[model samples]
Target: MIAPPARPDSLVRQDRFTTDESTADVAVVIVTYRNADSISTLVDSLRSEAAVSSIRVVVVDNNSGDGTASTLAAHDDVIVVAGEVNLGYAGAINVARSRIGATRAVLILNPDCVVQPGCVTALRAALREPGVVAAVPRLHDVDGRLSFSLRREPRLPATLVDAMLGARLPRRPVWASETIRDVAVYDRAHSIEWATGAAMMMSAGALDAVGPWDERFFLYSEETDYFRRLRSHGLVLYVPEARVEHTGGGSGSSQALSDLLTVNKIRYVQKYHARSFVTAFHAVTLFGEAVRCWSSKHRATYRAVARRHEWSNLLRAETPRPTECRDMGSVVIPAHNESRVIARTLDALADLAARGVVEVIVACNGCTDDTARIAAGRPGVRVLDLDVASKTAAMNGADEVAELWPRVYLDADVVITPAAVVDLVTALADGTLLAARPASRYDATGAGHLVRRYYRARSSLPLVRSHLWGAGCYALSEEGHARVGRFPDVVADDVVVDAAFATDEKIVVDTDPVVVLVPRTPAALIAVLSRNYSGNRDAPATTSSTGTLRHVAGTVHGPGTLLDAAVYCLFAALGRRASRRTSARWARDDTSRT
Candidate 1:
């Protein structure tokens, strides 16, 4: 019999990330708590991925005062978001997703992971099939030794066995027989219950359908929750033909986080498994706790985790609400400096708020003006003043504080009637649509040839015809919010939300038309178009979600639309060229401002 390859000799460590960045096709999210040393080495390895088109690196520094953000700040390609409060691993990932915008695939990675050449390629290739939600690469330890990378869900029998024997013997195959087989037989790729969030290339479409990570889980069981959400959507979790070295052991030393992990695990078991299973798990865990009491080295860490209150929360029949329940349907409007139009937007939805069907949450992010004060003045409109300017962050902050579902992500600039808000909530109540957005009527009176032509041609398409996004506003059903949790930190959140569902699952609710302000001038059009282009930067260039005929038919409404299409083509070519020259903070069209 052939013996397994021996672990490679250790190498010297020199920490650095190369300046070279690809034309990013993937948004690589690295949520670091600390371990700046490990992250530096991993970044260096990632720089070697020149074969990959583009890698957008979003480093969410979860208040790691150890200067991890500053360490990565020098790298031009890296976008670092300061989590002044550690949003935990799951929350960080959700923030990273928004920052990623609309990339074809998202890579959820650990700060300590290093990938081999073609690893990303294989992961991306696996996601080409529609059924595959995520693809995990095989993991090797720093020593290039194969670690225990796969396992079935924790069962009571396995737990009892591992506690009774595996804890003591340390190498008994009988303790975790199936897990042992998984490691031994891992010669090829296969389906798994969940992939380690350490390094997995997930389909953006799948993420849209599954939503964001459940922020309730601090760290440990986040992947399990993600898997559960994905599985609920009938998506497959695939293992691809590639390998990555994920240095096991995160900032796992934090006793608080570790305790939370233990609690999350118990909750996971109780939530998914049977009552008997939970009882068995607690019994098995007690045995392990008893074993730990005999081991002096583990007493502190073990005692910190095995708390009665934490266990009781899970064993109880009722689930704890994430936030207060003053409201049922939530309308979260993320604003930066929209003091001019904030009141009007709030007034439009005042009827729904008055009826008690909705509560408006104006998350005023990075507002220097009286946006918050003005929003707060409105009766029934709750104002959330945020320090960060990110729309995704504001939405997340709102989600964090408000225990409301069937959330509506309303754009401050769009003007939709209160009746429309009522219709949206009513539509959401039926559970027919994953998401719904109003049909738009563009303000074309003051527009130029190119600008008017673009909107006219766009209006003919499915976005105006049968699809969404032409309108700035959209509503998420409770199921929609459940499937796709928090808003990602992105400029074009509508596109990201719109991509998460099929036509059958979502709709263009034209009951009450939404008035969209078109760019008044060619210059304004260029500025707005440039921003729009930037919004679409990392997103899929094209998606089959909307068919070809739907795309073309949008341009053929009338002879006038044919002329509109001609001008639109001219501007599109010109716009694409000008868009490249746009800076990160591109100019917005002020034509809509009253």
Candidate 2:
């Protein structure tokens, strides 16, 4: 645990104080809500030598029922302002802004955030640049994953595109999240449209010009509206060379809060746009909300809030017009012997395809039954029949039929989730050869989570080479496929094709996972794993003997590395146990059938 900076003043001051002898001029305000557990850490992080020597710290305890006041009282550097009741984020920040006074800059930080060393200095330096109104630091989740802190203000059309079709229509799929793309393209010195309120610094001059956050938005969309206001004044938002760790959703978690977020989003649209814009925005948002409420597990709460808002918006007269764009890519499913689940898969694919992300290609590979005929029965679907047993061969067949068009490969048995295909295709960048779709299991066995983690960890390692590409689902560039000499005819063609490229040239995986029905019977699981192991064993070794030895040793005894060999052995034992059970069940079923 990091320690807080020592207090320079004898006593904590309530009102803003001027220090003529300042090195870097800025003040940071953090608002807390029942965050006593993490307040000390947050205060310490903000009061670190790098932050304290340059900036002031203001801790706003939003009438937290927890012992939040005591936590702030212990920190001498923190000027604790206790609210009478639990004020929402916008209200709390507004209170802090009043005490911030005339500093060169003001930083809005969350209580659960910890600034990386020198982050304040970097943000302040970035703001000093001309035309830059605010500079937000790159924020990472507690697990050191990048948060989508930077973003374009959400428009109704963009929301519809994202909700219905997917990000593929954006032309830059790699920039699905506003923050990651902003960090990648915009330099430490470049500008952006908006950023997350998790950790953002604004110049005092800009704040004075644009004014405070829109208080009407009690929670969400306030920052978005603020950035809009800032842009109106010709001040651009900049992302500087700074990093902050954010513990996601520390303050708001209640169903009430979730409803508030939904309602406030509507309020944001109403506040910013004209009557015409508001009308169209409300229509799309309300429709989307109704669908969301109906489908959500928390239907009672979501529906109640959504219906109320919809009724309120219905009385309004004028509405805004929506933007339109060209739809790209066809979702292509290749099937063989999928009579049981072919209709369901096609149905799900059709719903997604209707979003205009990609066209559906249900290429029937070596199917002697109604798989091809069933697929052809669907409207707007072009079905192709192919007499190929190999997975790679099937893909090749699909490619030949859909020549020059980008295609997404979907397995016959797998169920694609809502917007998953769109998300995958939209996230594709210029150099990305393939985009790996995430897979979720039908059962909540936690195996999918572990598999995802394993894939992510292994993918990051420079030594681990990917040869066994998953045939379940993945998208490939038609040109990129041709460039890479097409998919190889191997047992596990996906892995084989994945290994052909350099690590940097392979398909990138996203968090939006596809749902896969795991083998319910142990025999099926073992068969899949055995086939995978066999494919891996037969594939030529990509790593040298020396590298393999090093990998083994690292698995055995490396700092921070778990005993993976033992773990692998344990999983193998579990597989054996499952196989025995499966065999017994199969024997009993056979006897009954006879």
Candidate 3:
């Protein structure tokens, strides 16, 4: 892994970003509190993505003592604003928005949310559809479990139902229904009433028309109120194909920030409903919460926060949004004695660039053939020739381009599709350290299909550490390469590089197939695997030697291991049978179609 670049003397400064005046189509705002550990990841993701052409990331730090301000200042792309105090979520967002003059849309994201590649693009596309005032992507947890962030607006009766009977009453049965009409389960793609603010994208037009978020309510229900207001104006909220992993609950110290939550809920009801309903609803709900808290021994904590008369003041504090610093990145492709394959790779890249994928910088190393010539012929593809034959040396030499922009290392033999590049860029945009795709090998016998299916299943297991595989066809942001240092000069350079970042950095394997072309022969396969084993031998063991030995023994003898082995054998046998049937069906289909 490459080391992060040195912090600039002074972070970039902007007056204010305006939705009307700004050329950027989207602006992402992250309200952060003590997020020093995760802020860099967020900025890195934004900087490396190519799908989002023009973006401004505003990070509002809520007076965190966690070195968050300095960390945000390190990035050229982020606008870091430090709050005077720990302002609640709404206050911090307002502070951030004060600096953002205008944008086509405002993307409200939690500091911990890691958006998949192309998620923003999908959200932007969804927002463009008529009447969509706001839209949210599907949210997943850290463990990749889906979190149903989309929900219907809470009615007064539903709130009363919950307040009176609690979980016993089937209040909000709309969420429970599994039918297609129930927006939660209808995954194919459709509209919805409201999505969680963990990662919501709202049109600038809608935001301006609705005015600022009601400052009376701080964190929760702020989104609910915003959605309700948008709906009142006859605009619709939607859930798009985009996805984000929300690490929820960043501000509060305990699970029961119940008083603050209750206060906000009361404020929301007061703002939207009639006085009678608000009074009745607030009384019942507060009483219900009081009962629950008393039973759960959380009444004191709730009462203490509510005792503070300045609860409303907590919602109004403002902070400025972080400014985006320019982060330039370069793409480095190391080519060997390839002339034929190099052109195809260059063509695919050119297509990507044409579609606004990424800027390319090709480094042709140890090519005895016309690899340099072919690379130079392509527009925007810079050719770097190295006299040495070593792959590690070629990659190290390519690091020279890192001086200009963050560098992404690419191999010449692999062809990256445009969609794959978009996916990778999107993942990088959301702050993934290293992003890659499974290598799709071509085969006429359908063995490739079977291998891919099995590989995917195995890869999804919790025990599997994906970065153990070498960087077959991968893209690393310049910052990632710099932080990680140069690729280790070894026979298995990729494996060594993977090991370097496996622990600290996020290595994302996008669902898309970025590299088409895998080892075709047994010799090629053995060479790759042997190099990996060699790297593994040289690499520092994460566990103790005793543990390692025990693990190895278990793999050879344990029942779970034995079962997995048996499953693999069964799958292989079944795949052969399935392949024969598929071939026969394909032949019949071809005959019928002809």
* TM-score of each candidate structure, all chains considered together: 0.50, 0.46, 0.46
**Candidate 2 C-alpha lDDT tens digits along 434-517:** 434433323223344343333333322324322325426766665546655666666555555555555444433322345555
TM-score of 2: 0.46
In candidate 1, which residue ranges exceed 4 Å CA deviation? Answer: 1-24, 167-183, 233-240, 296-306, 310-594
- What does candidate 1's lDDT look like per residue over 353-401, in tens digits? 6666678888999999999998888877888888988878988898887
Q: Which regions of candidate 2 deviate over 4 angstroms?
A: 1-24, 49-52, 165-183, 186-189, 290-294, 297-594
lDDT score at residue 260, model 2, on the 0-100 scale? 61
Report the poorest 10 consecutive residues by lDDT, candidate 3: 585-594
Q: Using alpha carbons, what is the TM-score of model 3?
A: 0.46
Ranking by lDDT: 1, 2, 3
- lDDT, residue 119, candidate 1: 82
Per-residue lDDT for 456 in model 3?
35
**What would the per-residue lDDT of candidate 3 be over residues 130-163, giving only the tens digit for each residue?**
7677777887788977675666655665665565
